[model samples]
Target: MISTVPHNVRGVAASCPQCTSSLGRIWHPDMRIPRGWALAAGLFYLLALAGPFVQISIFGRLQRADIATGPLQLTVQGFDLVGFLVLAVTIIFPGIKLGIVLLTLFGIRLEHQPTRFLKAIFRWYPLIGPWAMVDVYLLGFLVAYTRLTAMATVHLDLSLFALVGLMISMAALDGSLDTGAIWDALDTGPAPRPIDADHRGGHLIGCHCCFLINRAEPGMACTRCDTVLRDRKPDSIVRSWAFVIAAMALYIPANLYPVMLITQLARTTPFTIMGGIVELFAAGLWPLGLLVLLASIAIPLVKLLSMACMLIEAQRPSGRHLLGLTRTYRFVAFIGRWSMIDVFMVSILVALVRFGQFANVQASTGAACFAGVVVITMFAVESFDPRLMWDGAREAAPETPPDPTLIAEPA
Candidate 1:
């Protein structure tokens, strides 16, 4: 097949002779958020808004709450922490995230150069996305509240409506937002995507000035300064081993530590992510059980292993699985923080439930440890640059410099 790429920069270790190109294009307005993410958030917002209106009972009586006046108003009754947590997470954060998405996708419909503000927003995308877990918060709350009111009538109020509204709003936002398309729009360059299609020798090259990713033609000079880049990874394998070791250290306690503390009628159950799933399953709540397992447990472990394998291969500059490895690291780094969902749940719980002797929940040392694990792992993934994988794909030139005297005479 004829080469689509020009002179090979793969042979040059340090420079690129070809001009720089970037993948930038106008994207569809709605194809921004990941699948079902924004919609889910908007849905939960609706649910949370409706939470005040939805009521249950104990004995022959009924009580009620309102979104603005219900648990949120608990602040007046000295429930500061609980009031604050519920307000911020179930209400404030989701609203902010949705607003940002709306502005980015619809308000700023025209794609242009990515300014500093846009890039900053892009980087924090994952962090804001998953915080819209009003439904999860609602589930935990309803479960805990039901157990609490076994002795008394539980009633619904205006707050129920707000909670319902909160849930639906979050759902609408998540469903409508599109993450990949947003990034594509933000790139703002006219160049095609630099991702390699085939493991062709010439299309891959290393920039000597900055060991960054670039493409080169077979036997072509550096795209930057026309320098020859021939060196593969000198110690790629060993370095990946180091990353694996570090990830292993954090993965241990991330599971063992308590992520949530459930207190019901003087009985406290300290539950980690796995413990929560087990408890739910033991209680015959299969759906919630499986959901937690998939979200909290399975995804994190998968991310960890995927990152390790990718970094290891990248460190070696190996030919096999470079693209897959690249993608693996991207996902690992991308999703690492959401693995902290357990921690965030803990944060929400601790803040929302404080009956002060009647009933209260507090974050524990174990939760902190597990939180550390998630954060550290995320940092590790972010720090272990995926760009390094491209290093090995480009072979370095031999040490022998060509002799000037042996140069052929001009024809």
Candidate 2:
């Protein structure tokens, strides 16, 4: 029989004996607070998008842009992929995530059975939460604003303040959200299936997507969410290696090529990633320059190297430092996307600074390659399975040799 047992003293984790997988966390009872935060954030998000976000005055001409301006400008500039990425992360996913939170909270209040659609929405909450990058986008805006101030008189608008508030509210909502508590509130059915002691074949599999623990063969659909089940992520090592290697290859050209082309007074100048940072430092913006260096140059390299190490360790039989490796994998996954700050900065600049031949910002080939590196590294991190590290250790454990004293008596 499957039973819930605290995996930590703080009650943060519970393990399923059947699949040996973490089921959910045990959170405090104040889970309803995030619902209010989500609602406030949703309102702030609408306001942020509706008005002028930032105003720039170049040579006595004023230009204003809203939140949608970046993506639209990028698409018009022929960088459709990057445009869609910014839109999805900054606008689309945040709205969907906040709406889901509101809907799930409201659904709990209804004195009726929860529908499958509602359950599905709640299931996707954790998956979609990380992709909502408003906070990261705000950081990108800061970098862009710093750069713009050096060239033009930049004015922060009401929408900018609203966007800041929106980011803060979303952060608060995420902080207050209790995943385990939310799952418990949404579950209105029988307990998860237990692993039968007498069952044949392999161990019980847990659905990473839906948190359903069940006894089933690989490639079967999850009974609860219908997601295909796997003992581990399919071809985890191979896929991660492929993405990591590709990212590493792209990293070369991404750094060597100019990321942005600045046209000032009818003269064009190209700036590579480090070149931009050096220019920022030369202009006395040491802090922002340091930020860009860390986000653009350091973070990606660390992610690639760290992921490679984890993958190598996972594939080996050595039982050394499995816990540390698991923690490293989690950290790599969390920080992989922050490297997009430079990309977002480029987008904002391209959108705001356009005074044809007098002052303009254009994305260079390096921007596209760097974006590819960031995205591919993120996929590599996601494609990896931390559980494989532990599984390797378990499989590598030396079996206890048959006790000589307890050897069976001769029949």
Candidate 3:
């Protein structure tokens, strides 16, 4: 009776009171509406890329910064890794996502749908969706705007407006998307998979691309989406441990070193992550200061701790609060990217504030280390599959454990 439905709820959060599994989407959205929203988002995305994002003036010195300018400045300052990270998330990934959406939807609408081609492009739609972080970038811009206004005159530009529009459109498109329905449309034929021949017999393997359940071996291709299937993610435990350990090593330098160096009137001051948060509070902006503290400091610590706990639990599967642990994993995975707020803020400041010692901002080594921690943690989460937690619990009490997959209908 295990339900294999994907847990992506939109309407009122309804779950089976008995087992606590999410009830799938309460209401399906019109497919056409999503296309329109995607189109609008794509247009705004183009506009946002074309014009100046913001302008700043300090002591009669003016600097104009566009979306790409921050990443360019970071590279110029020798933070190539951080620069490439920002550029991929803010610009390249977003464009790729939009293109995937438009092409898939258009292909689906064709008289003779190109199922294989559509499936190939759409497979990446969800995988890359989270990395397209336009909304997070806007929040980073807000923090940067506050800092800029405190020191000099700042002007919002057309590109900023376009970015705002793009964010809204992307939000709407995501809200209205029915991934289940799209998968259904693309799956016009039965999954083409090999028959299980092992003595133990193959277990139910979920396709990572389409979420279609298939009974197959670890390395078999999914019948529906053709994605390689595995009993669990390959080397999930070991990879997670490696990433977590590396991130822990970087966490020390990320905290100890200065993330940004500011020069004012021939005097330079270095700001660690904590120092920036303190400055915001000193300026009587405790709300924003609190946000920076949570996003940059508290969240990363919690994520690391939670991940460690989950890794331990996976080793010795138990029945105690397994659901809570799974929920924690999801929360950590979702908020991990928000930690990039400080990195983005540093990039913006570097791009906008340059006055040759009178007033200037430069990214430092700490920024690069912190970015590594964030990106590495995200990879750790991705590498560690949550289902391993449930599988562990099931193994501990095979008869007593209620199937976690049995609560809702499969999408």
lDDT leader:
3
lDDT for every model?
A: 0.52, 0.81, 0.86
**Comparing 1 and 3 on lDDT, the stronger one:** 3
Off by more than 4 A, model 1: 1-250, 260-269, 330-338, 351-359, 396-411
Question: In candidate 3, what residue range of length 10 has the lowest lDDT sum?
Answer: 192-201
After superposing candidate 2 on the true structure, give the runs of residues whose Cα lies further than 4 Å from its correct spot: 1-25, 192-202, 210-212, 399-411
RMSD, every candidate, angstroms: 11.9, 6.9, 3.7
- What local lDDT score does residue 92 receive in model 3, on the 0 to 100 scale? 98
Clashing pairs in 3: 2-405, 2-406, 3-405, 3-406, 191-223
Residues 1-411 of candidate 1: C-alpha lDDT, one tens digit per residue: 111322222221121111111111122344544334545545555555554444443333343443344334435545455445546655676777765665555434555543446555545555566555556556545544433454344555665555656666656555445454465456444554455445444456654322324566445554432345544433444554555566577567767776555666677877766877777788787776776676567766786677667765664556666566766675675565445445445543444455544445566555555545555565556456555655545542223322211111111
Report the alpha-carbon TM-score of model 2 versus the true structure. 0.88
Q: Is candidate 2 or 3 superior in lDDT?
A: 3
TM-score of each: 0.53, 0.88, 0.92
What is the lDDT, from 0 to 100, of the residue 334 in candidate 2?
Answer: 85
Off by over 4 Å in 3: 4-23, 191-203, 403-411
lDDT of 1: 0.52
